[model samples]
Target chain A: MRNAANLRVQVESMLESRIPSALTPKIKPPLESMSCGISDIDRFKAFGRGTLVEICGAPSTGRTTLLHGLLAQCTAGGEAAAVIDTSDTFDPVSASQSGVVLREVLWVRCGVPRNQGRALSRLDQALGAIDLLLQNGGLGLIALDLANVPIRDARQIPLSAWFKFRRAVEDTRTLLVVLAQQPNAGSSSATMLDVSQSSVEIEESDKPSVEKHIDGDCLIRTLRNRAEVLRGQMTKPVRSVRTIGEFSTSLYSYR
Target chain B: MLYAGVHLPNFPAQAALRNDAEARQKPFAVVAGTPPQVRVVALNSHAKKMGLWVGMTKADAETQSSVKIRERLVRLESLAHAALQDCLAGFSPWCEDVAPDLFVLDISGLSNLMGTPVQIAKSIREQARTFSLYIKIGVAHNIDSAIHAARLTKNVLVLPTGGEAEILRDAPLEILEATPEILGILHRWGIRRFGQLAALPELALSERLGQEGLRLQRLTRGISTRILSPTVPSMAFEEEMEFDHSVEDLKSLAFVFHRLLGQLVLRLATRALAAGEIHLTLHLDLAADGVTAKEPFFTRTLKLPVPSVDVTLLLKLLQLDLEAHPPGAPVMKVVLHIEPMRPRVVQNGMFVPQGPEPQRLELTLAKLRRIVGEDRVGSPELMDRHLPVPFRMANFTPSNSPSRKLPAEVSQTAVRIFRPALPTSVEKVRGTPRRVRFSGKSYQVSHASGPWRRSGEWWTRGHWGRDEWDLVLVSGDNKRIVVRAYRDLVTGHWSVEAEYD
Candidate 1:
């Protein structure tokens, strides 16, 4: 290790006038990450503070579950958070089951019918709400849920809008997470997670675990899913030791 | 103890000037009582020059060419009285509400902080000008002497202590505000000044006018020993303005709101209070239309998250709300009322986490409500019922002290609910095998859960019963999904309720 350090110094000194320490790699400060309060995801990757994150997946792929986990951790730690539901799909019981303090969350539901012709359309209104939340800078977390929106409509959102949101939250402690079926924030997202259902091998004799006498109604089964980090902080992805994360859900919603 | 008195002359005319610039230049006369006996109770100098005396009838005052005759509004006078007391309270706390337009304060021990008596009186006069009132101030050794001195002085007068009687010797008898009967007798006896009234034989005055006559005689002689009656600060905080030309646009109306909110905020700050709620009323100009509209006023009330005296924030919230629900017609008058509250005091700990600021969050919610609908922004509260999707929206108020109990390491997965459940076709084979189809997609039931029965609201007109099912469906290509499905017992309709994540 000592010989390698000496060689790097000698090479940088020889190329000082030409490239100004061209052999030395530029080091960046480590990004601070807030725990999602779930070992399944935290073991692999955690969303960074003062940065934009995106969670995209197919239906029933644990997209909302991950967002709820992040919110629960934020609220339980004595901070406030907000969710702008573009499709009016936020379930209060499910969020409560996820351990989120309901009082600490500001839920803004976009229930207006789609007025495509108007300048301030449904998507624009949602974006405007997010902008307002960003301008008021004390919230710990803000999630924008656009999962149920059609991809065709979501693509109409300009790249400049994402850049604007990224700039707004760049240096602040607010962590903005966007939920959708596809990564709509383009390159502006500091971290993007692609999710899908993780297949579990089950033998015919090995039936799924079910609660027999407790709930007295529906049978419960454990559902599993996986997430892969598509992009993240630290110019190179070498700092991340784990690449994929696996998590599960309850079949009958004990929540 | 040195006492000070501040009195508003011609209070009825002054109260009528609710920021009306024309009332100061033009002749103004305020009348009271019913139709036959309505007489001018107060008149400005310009009105006095136009042959409009205090005893003239409203009709006679109208006959004078440029006289502006207005009815006496008790509300305006009360508000003016409140403003007068607020101004005096800044100089000293022990102020007495003597009359609608008169107040006296005990300025005995303010020498070190407020300099001499003359300087304190000068400071009070400046405060009255900020309140849009023309007042006369007086300082004397006794309450009655102070009151009479205010009535006699041009602007301000401070009499030396221990010589109150000599200083007020030349003041007229009317300055005492005595009973009319005693005044008539004093006039018949050829006494028009305080010096003359003091010289009358004390025994002869008591025998003729009884106990009341002696009280008046002593009051004029500046020998009053009455204690000061403390005044309580009023809770009402409101400002009203009437425009000569009706305002039709929101942008123009915001300027008016800014002006009014500044005054209200300043008043609250003077009292060390904050506004907890705001009530606004816009008197519409519906008289211009040919049709008769019974309700011509548009009103809106906003309850703030916390008590705040921030003028910009209050104005922004008002502007946003007015933009959402505008008045149907042009507004002729606007009244803004505030509910006062003690300002919140918070001692923040160093280890405490940061949250959304109450004032800015409230402002953000108002802007969001304007963009979305009013009912779309708030915290969600689960209803206490067994029915499907039971919940209500409430205003979000984050507690300062968060729950100390932390969540477990492993999180419970949440489900995404479809607001209106989608209808689907399910083919059941002996209640075991099934094929579900929805939104032009087909799925085979790889595994199925039992049918959970749930029902509620049986006694009301809206009754519901459903059999819920949890199913793990697999497509032809092996893509899998888990969803909650329910069958309505009344309509026999099957729908996909929510997708488990």
Candidate 2:
């Protein structure tokens, strides 16, 4: 009887080991991963809409020129754009020369105060106008031409204000572009396009000294935390500068 | 009653004064100084009849006219035009600056307030006379006729019905403002005067000049059918209320903000728009204090997701933000401006219902955004392919992102997960499995996988290069664990990086 009981126990242990007990299927949780892309523009393009692209630079650094180029591209793509001219610096003749369709661009002039006494009030009014355009949205490129805005005053824009603006831009496909003399306020996520005039030469005829003409070369640096790793400082020489009518046109070695 | 056109004859006395402020008596003519390559910008009317025409070079003008010449300054002309515009503001509120020193005024329904149009014109001319500028006035049924009559006849030109063609018949083609190319084409067709062009068949004109020619033909016929639509004034998203009592406290001011936000939201929703940014203005009630009313203080705009008309949400967000950064002083009246409301397109899903529910998501996100801020909320958006550490990442508002298509031919390699992996030190061995020590606990390796290596972005500022290994080990508890190990390319030290659950 003892030999028979031991045999039964041995048989049960072998069967349990060989047959394998029933196991529950592991419920796989949904994977949370971000969609990846190559470049900032590519990442934005994947979102499938025109975004706010800000081109900011110091004085006489081809800020307007770059803006005109972008505007032309947008128009060619059958997209509309608006310019909030806080400094009354938008020249239509130059815009047309840069290939922007004048009819397609909505130019809002934020008139400055003629009186020196009301300068602060005028500045506030201009900012209000800029705020209006940004909130309206639906623009392929809404450029705030703060290139002519005083850097000291523009710096007065609080950092929190920039964060709010960045938050406003978040998911919407609109590319928010701010054109300023310097990087004043924007989220760390903002793509900063910095432009600087490399060399400038002023030429005037000996007889007609009243006519002051200028020739200059500009260097544009597109810096972002998320751009391709380029070796050294990417530099391009701009050549051939001439003023046609009211606009100054230049040709660069690289596009 | 006001005429739309004006002309100024070149006064020889004024020309003499311009040539030499010292020489008081010599007769002179104001002539355009055109460079050799460029056309003459402008010329005095007196210089025109002296056989010196516009577009003539300075040398040519000197040879053609016997009268002593003084160059007309384009800058001075523009300045004078601006002065005239300012002066005309007394006559009409609406004025348009036309090119080459012309001003178009809409004197409609202002006859009683500013007297008759004729009286207004006389007042404007008188103002110009005070500035020592010569002037002419033309009154007509419409602007085109008035301008034409002022140019064609040196008097106010009135046109009734189809009198436009008759008046323009004898006028020169230059008055039509047609481009030189169109003029050359018209000259080829033997059409010189405005009357000749106006007399052509519309179909023929359309064929010759295309649409532009057709427009000119219509303009010349005194059709004057186009209405002068005034420019629409800029629209603002401002809501303001006068306080029954000029209370000046922070708490009361916050209440005013609540009420203003409520009104602003209603207006925004009615227009199907969402406010992306908002500005707060606090007006001080200093009228009783015998001081000039100061301008309202402007707050740096606060941006929001989706257009929200909710007073409570706005109040909560504003209160928190404002408390963190409050206004400088007490305010009497508060104004809220929710500007730049984007047109809200409510997309009703085909299979799902649409209502206030989805908006609730935006409100919830906004509340969370207000607390933790905009940066910490959303998924990391990959902006560039530079350093992995400093790669661009942005927080996006939660919304239906368009689905991303995964690229084909992806590697089927299993990805390692990092959970509670403790750093482990292992003694050197061959390229295969070996016993490892982790957290003062020893484990025996049963299975192993992986030699997956990744290199960092060395072309940029920061770079990393490491070789990773995945090893499965059995513990004394009879439980199995997978540990990932990597050797620092620089230091040549191996460390446990992660573990599989």
Candidate 3:
């Protein structure tokens, strides 16, 4: 009886192995993932294709820095990236230092208005642009940088827009990153990272650093003895809120 | 077979019917001449069935109350002829527009590019279908035989090589397109069909009827000793339409543009060419001293990134441009000129990531430009200078050319400049910024570096000088802000310049 039972078990295992793959449930391989180019944040979460990532933080919290890193990683892999810059705060010189290929990056600057009401209208246009870019697809990364946009104006953005973007990016290898002062996309995003500046440390120099800072619209620039870069750290929300490391990387330091 | 001919039957009636669809399937005749004595130039089959002949006087034709008559439009005849010539240009370089309703092409060596001569004839007929024009094609060893065969056949007729005379024997002498006097003399001689005309002695006909009769005899014998004077293709691919009335709405304008673009694209495709640029000139009906005048023109030229023949893409681009820069008055006439060029062949790199389609990319860029101001969208190109944020917006044309490898010593740090640098109040400790106040908020400068001085353009009155500093500031909440601030040396004012990403 024991020998007969062993034969039955062997026959069952052989049948299972012989079954065509089409007859069984497919085990999908893991999704293609990429790092945000920041070691501290990469450990907790990595961006994946066809996913929405939100980087929310107040002004001067390294939101722009995180955006640069994402763009850099995308372009460094020979992929193209774009920034729908609401409030017109994208600085190419600073972005290039974060390892972004400027040639591969498309910078679309939404008009910056001085009044609050006009600023809200500008936000609407920016959202439309986001939808346009998402529908167009083929982009490795599309960053909607609204960090400088008023929080109230950013809030006026309909939640349905986020869901629309989520649907547009599904089954595609494009990453949609929304950078804002606070979380605006709600639950539609696949990954939500809250960035904050924890501390500020200014490097000391004997002579004041004054490199040429061209302000064409204002036309005020001058040269100084030395250049300074400010570095800082944010440590909290170990799981959700990610802080930026390598704060010492300054504008002059990259060049 | 070396030559082919296209025959458009009842051309006048058909041309009129093209613009008046309701008149189709009706007994109609196109008449031209003085009113009472106006004679029918062409009549449709239904009209012919109604006993309306081409020479019938208008008054007599009107006696048949059911027959409809439309004045022959000379302009339409010319346009249709040009259109036919453009279409036939694709088959062979030697195309002769012999009449308003006739075309002959020299297809001597097109067997390799287009199959056999019969296939070429069929292809010509098929391409003409796009215009809803029905044409009969004939191919033969000589032009005269080809012309005769085209008129006699219902569709495509290919005469056997060296058998033109035998095949053309039954055709009517009118197929030769001979003069009325010669035709009258031939009729008096009882030579109605080509066989009777060809049976006459050539020397006798030449002696009696002169050159005209000799040519007729040669045509009847299916012989063409004359050289083919092919019309040279026009350099400019252009179409013009003058509206019956001024069009004030975009929809009507777009509709007209759609038709024009279709015809232009067909012309370009026939020659294996693409449009490099579209120069659209709209004649406006603007009021001069409150009087409607018609000379004002609004011209806009759209340059294509790559030569393209895609009608939809071209139309969209044109519509976008028109939307952005609308004419000041109603449009009375529109002319479209296409610059023709060979399309560029692009070979994508093996490792480079795929980008959006070039046509799509250009269209998307145009849309973005409309949404934002024109100067706000484009790839960033750094200006060659030490000036901060020294760059300008330019036309965006994506390059597939390989990017140059970066130097080992180039800096990796990039700075994002804030436009209209935020004006700030600074408390300087011995000419060094120690505190900053901007947007009703103040920050203590934890660390400050700079006083870098750069000034130039002394030759002009607009000279600039500034003291710059890169600072790490601590807000009241102890939130950190890294910024680059500058003080105007001449104005004695301070402003926040840019932030390091």
**Model 2: chain B TM-score relative to the native chain B:** 0.40
Q: Residue B74 CA error for candidate 1 (Å)? A: 2.2
lDDT of 1 by residue, B1-501 (tens): 989988899998898884565678999989999989999999889988877789888888888878877788898888778877777777788999998988999999998888999898888888778777899988998998899889889899897876777878889999887889889998998899898888888999999989888898898777888899888878789888877678777788887788778767877877888999999999988877542435788899989879999999999999888777767688899899999999999878898887778898899898888777889899888889767878899998888466788877544667788878989899886564389998789999876665778889998878899888877789888888888888999999999988877
Order of models, best DockQ first: 1, 3, 2
lDDT of 3: 0.73
Off by over 4 Å in 1: A1-29, A113-120, A200-220, A234-242, A252-255, B19-27, B33-40, B43-68, B185-191, B195-217, B238-263, B281-299, B326-336, B475-478
* A73-121 per-residue lDDT for model 3 (tens digits): 7776667778898878787766665666777788888874322133435
Q: Retained native contacts per candidate, as fractions?
A: 0.67, 0.00, 0.33
TM-score of chain A of each: 0.77, 0.56, 0.69
Candidate number with greatest DockQ: 1
Residue A112, candidate 2: how far off, in angstroms? 46
Which tens-of-lDDT digit does each residue in B1-501 have in candidate 2?
Answer: 334666554433342242122332333445543355443434554555656655566566566544455555554454345445445555555665554445566766766776765675666677665544556666566776666666666544545456668867878777776899998888887888888888899997787679889878877887565445332222355655445356545666666676566545554554455666788776665555544435445365777656666667678667756654545444565667677567556675563311123334344334333333343223233233543222222332323221132222111111122222346666544454477887677878654444556776888666788766655566787545445677678877667654321
Q: Say which docking band candidate 3 falls in.
A: acceptable
- In TM-score terms, candidate 3 sits at 0.80
Model 3 per-residue lDDT tens digits across residues B407-430: 122223335567889999998775
In candidate 2, stretches whose alpha carbon ends up further than 4 angstroms from where it belongs are A1-255, B1-233, B238-254, B266-272, B279-301, B319-337, B352-358, B369-374, B383-424, B431-445, B448-450, B491-496
Candidate 1: C-alpha lDDT: 0.82
